[model samples]
Each structure stands twice: as structure tokens, then as C-alpha cells.
Target: MKIEIWSDVMCPFCYIGKRNFEAALAKFPDRDDIEVEWKSFRLDPAMPEVPRYQENMYQFVAARKGISYDQSVAMHEQVARMAENAGLDYQFDKMLVTNSLKAHRIIQMAKTKGLGEKAEERLFYAYFTEGKNLSDDAVLTELGISIGLTATEVKEALTNPVFQHQVEADGAEASRLGAKGVPFFVIDRKYAIAGAQPGTEILKVLQTAYAEWKKDNPGLIHVRQGNTCAPGNDCTN
Candidate 1:
């Protein structure tokens, strides 16, 4: 079964959701056969690559949502606690608020090399834990290289029109699927889970989808078999 996750690296919940889903997958019996594909979704496409002034993430969120600065801080604290429960350290105070387009491009390229999951995890760690700027070419290059992508490959992927298009295409597909937010998960195009749902919820859906999928993809069919002896007996019929 194939699982597609539409996520933005800047979304704090997406990282938490990734961890939760991974915990669920670990307990799944068919996890080895599951193909996970990371799809790009930009939380703020219009965000400037480089802000003119030093950016404060809490202030930015407060202004964008017409909420008070104190409220923003409170909400962030709540989310940080949730992240801690998921074994993630989200240093919101040290985070850099910038566009995640180039980061998504890196993930798109990494997918071709079968390292999409690593790319996603690295970028998430960079933005949330390490507080690196995703818009910085040098930062993106270093991060990509750390995930086994060559320096040349990382640079090319950042500037490649095809990778950029792939990023946009992924967002477009997410919109078409009626996902209004990040961390949207789809299983085999038959079931969809929205938001940062718990591992139990996600596992239930996975099991349900796999059950239906197994019917169409049965294993170990027996062909015309002759009279065979037991393991301890002779092979003569």
C-alpha cells in the first residue's frame, strides 16, 4: 500500500504528526510493504525569502491571525508541550520564519533518489529544532548534503525549474484533494486523514485500507499441486 503525506516543513504540527504516524506504522504488521511518499505543501507561499528586518515568529502569527502577542505565546507553549509528548523538541523561540519553497524543492529532488523521508525529517528538524532558515541557499545546500545528496545535486535541485514545478504541482494536487491545511494523509487514494490525528486513529485507518487492498492483491496462490509427501517423509507419490 502507498501512503502520501502532504506537509509543509514550517508547520509545527506536521512534524508532530509525522512522529505520531511513524509510531503507528511501527506497530503495523505490513509496515515493510508500505510505500511512503512525501508531498510538498507551502504554508505561506507569499512569505519573503529574506525579511527586511529581524523576524519574530510569534509576532508574525499574532498579526496574521489578528490575535494578541500574549495569546500567540500561549498557543506556542501549548504546541511545544504537545511536541514534547511526541519526543520532539520544538524551539519556537529560535525558529526562523521564512518561505519554505526551496526546501520543498530539495524534498522533490530527494524523492527521485529514494530519500524523501530523510529530506522531510531533516528539514523539519532544521526549521523547528535547529532554527535554520529554509530560504537560505547555503543552509539548504548543507542540509541536503547531510541527507546523502551531493553538493552539486543540492544546488541544481534548488534552481531546477522541474523541481520547482513539482513543488507547485504537489500543492495544487493537495488543494484538489480538498485539503485546506498541512499534514493531510492519504492511503491508497481510498482513505484520507486530516490534521494531526492520534496514532490509534491513523492505525485504524491503515488497517482498514490494507484489508480492502489485500483483497485485490492476495499472496501465495497455489497452482496445480501434485501429491506431495510431508517434510519427514519421502517425495514419492
Candidate 2:
């Protein structure tokens, strides 16, 4: 089975959805046969590259949604609790709000090195848990290096526009698929599950897809369709 996931590193639910999907995969009997491709989807593509240290997540959310700061804080608190249920510690106070284009590019590069999933996980953990700035080239380079990518390769991928097209293509594809949010999952190009669905729901979808995939690709089958004649009787009889 092939699973393509469109997600943004800055999305708290994306991280939570990742955990839920992984939990589902762990119980899948054909886990090893599954091929997962991580697609880039930026929540705030127009966000500035440089973050204002004076501004915090709550303030940013409040301004963007026209909600009160306290309301934003409460909302974040609820999201934090959801993340906690998925075993993630979200430090909203320290979380920085910035563009994730460069981060997506890095992930696109990691896909070539067979480390796309690792790169995505590292980026999410860095942003939500460690409060690392995704916009910083140095911080991104360090993250790349930590995931077995050389510093030189990381810097080159970030500074150059090599993987930019791939990242854009993923986003375009997401848009074409009618996706208006992050953490969207498509299985076998047939079934799609949007948002951070529960593990049981995700697992059920996986099983359903796998079953249908098996039905489509049932492998080779042998058939015996020969006619037998009596030993002592003539073929005409």
C-alpha cells in the first residue's frame, strides 16, 4: 500500500496525526509492504522569514483570527492537551511563528535520501517542542545534519532552489485535491482521511485500503482445466 500524507510542520495537528498514523501502521500486518511519502503543505506560506521575538504564538493567533489573546491561549491550551494525548509536548509559549517554505524544501531533499519521514519528525519536534526557529538557516542545517544529512548538503539544499519546485508541486497537488487544511492523508490514491483522526479510525482506514489493494493485486494463480477420459473407453464415447 502507498500512503501520501500532506502536512505542515507548523501544524500541531499534523504532528498529532503523524503519531496516530504511526500507531495504526504499527498494528498493520503488512506494515513492511507500505510505502509512505510525505508531501509538503505550508500553513502560512506568506509568513515572514524573520520572526519578531516580541510577538508570541498566542498574540499571532489572536491577531490572525481576530480573537482575544486569552481566547487564543485557551485554544492553544486545548491543542496542547490533544498533543499530550499523542505523546507530544507542545511549548506554545516558546513556539515561533515563521514561514516553513525552507523547511519544506529541506524535507523534499530528504525524500531523495530516504529520510523524508525523519526530517519531517525532526522539524515538527524542533518547532513545537524545542522552540527552534525553522526560518534560521543554521538551525535547519543542524536539523538536517542530525538526521544523517551532511551539513554541506543541507546548506546547499536550503540556499539553492533545487527542491523548491517539488515542494510547490506538493502544495499544488494538495490544492487540487480540495484540501483546505493540513494533515491530509491519501491511501492508494483512492481513500482520503482529512485532519487528525483517532488511531482507531486511522487503523480502520488502513485495513480497508489494504484489503482492497490485495483484492486488486492478487498475484499469479494457477489453474487446472484439463478433461479426463475413462482408461478403457474410447475418446469418442
Candidate 3:
């Protein structure tokens, strides 16, 4: 079975959802047979490439949603608590606000090398915990190196427009799937789970999908020939 996840690196819920899904999958019996693919989704494609120190994350969120800075801070605090529950330490105060297009493209390049999951994890950690700048080429190059990607490969992917289309395609597919937000999970292209659901809920969905898949595709069947007979010449042959 294949699972495709559409998420943005800057989305706090995406990291939390990833943890919950992993927890559920770890308890699943057929987890070894599952293939996970990470798809790109950008929350703010038009955001400028600036360091978080210039304008903090709270201010950016406040301006974007037309909410007060205090409200944005409160929202971020709530999300931080939720992240702590999921074993993540989110430093929203230090978090940077930048365009994720380059990050998404790097992820797309990592996907080609079968390191998509690693890239996603590293990017989430860098942005949420370390508060690194995602738009900086140097930072991205370091991230790529940490994930076992060659410096040359990372430079090529970042400098050129090689994986831009792949990122755009993933975004387009997310729109077509009617996904209004990040952290959308699709199982076998059949079951859809949105948002950061609980581990128990995710486990139930996984089990249900696996059961249905088994029911639809039973073990292979053998057909017997009527004209060609075995040595015993029995129809059972």
C-alpha cells in the first residue's frame, strides 16, 4: 500500500500530524509493506525571503489573518503546547517567515533520491525547532548534506529549476483533491484524512483501509484446464 502526504514544512500541524501518523504506523502489523510519499504544499507562496528577526512569526501571522498580534501569539502558544505533547519543541518566537517554494523544490529533489521522508523531517526540525531560514541557499545546502544528499546535487537542485515542476504538480494535485489546507493524508488514493488527527483515529483509518484492501484483493487464484489433463486424468487437475 502507498500513502501520500501533502504538507508544508512551516506548518506546525504538519509536523504534529507526521508524529501521530508515525505512532499509528509503528503499531500497525503490515507497516513494513507500506510506502510513504511526501508531497509538497506551500502555505505562503508569496512570502518574502527575509529572516525572522526582521519580523517575527507572530506579527506575520497577525498581518496575514487580520488578527491582533496578541491573538496570534496566543494561537502560537496553543500550538506550541500541542507540539510539546507530540514530542516536538516549537520555538515560534524564533521561527522564520519565508517563501517555501525553494524548500518544496529541495524536497522534490530528495524524493527522486528516495530520501523524501528524511528531507521532510529535517526541514520541519530546522524551521520549527532550530528556527533556521528556509529560503537561504546556504541553509538548504547544509540541510541537504545532513540528509545524505551530495553538496553538488543540492546546489544543482537549488540553483536550477529542475524540481520546480514537481512541486507545482503536487500543489495542483492537492487542489484537485479538494484539500484546503496542509497535512492532508491519502491512503492508497482511496481514504482521505485531513488535519492533525489523534493517533487512535489514524490507526483506525489505517486498519480499515488495510482490511478493505485485503477484501478487494484476495490471494491469487489458480484456474484448471478442462482439455489438458494430469497423469490421473482427473478434472481436479
The candidate maximizing lDDT is 1
Please list the residue runs of candidate 3 whose C-alpha ends up more than 4 Å from where it truly belongs after superposition: 51-54, 220-237
Q: Tens-digit lDDT track for model 1 on 1-237?
A: 899999999999999999999999999998877899999999888888875333687888888789999999999999999999999999988988888899999999999999999999999999999999888899999999999999999988988899999999999999999899979999999999999999999999999998898887898343666888878887765
Question: What value does the lDDT take at residue 76 in candidate 3?
Answer: 93
Model 2: residues >4 Å from true position, as ranges?
A: 51-55, 220-237
Query: lDDT of all the models against the reference?
Result: 0.91, 0.90, 0.89
Clashing pairs in 3: none
Error of 2 at 212 (Å): 0.7
Off by over 4 Å in 1: 52-54, 219-237
Q: How accurate is candidate 1 locally (lDDT)?
A: 0.91
Clashes of each: 0, 0, 0
Better of 1 and 3 by TM-score: 1
TM-score of each: 0.91, 0.90, 0.89
Clashing pairs in 1: none
Taking every candidate in turn, the Cα RMSD to the unseen true structure, in Å, is 5.9, 9.5, 7.2
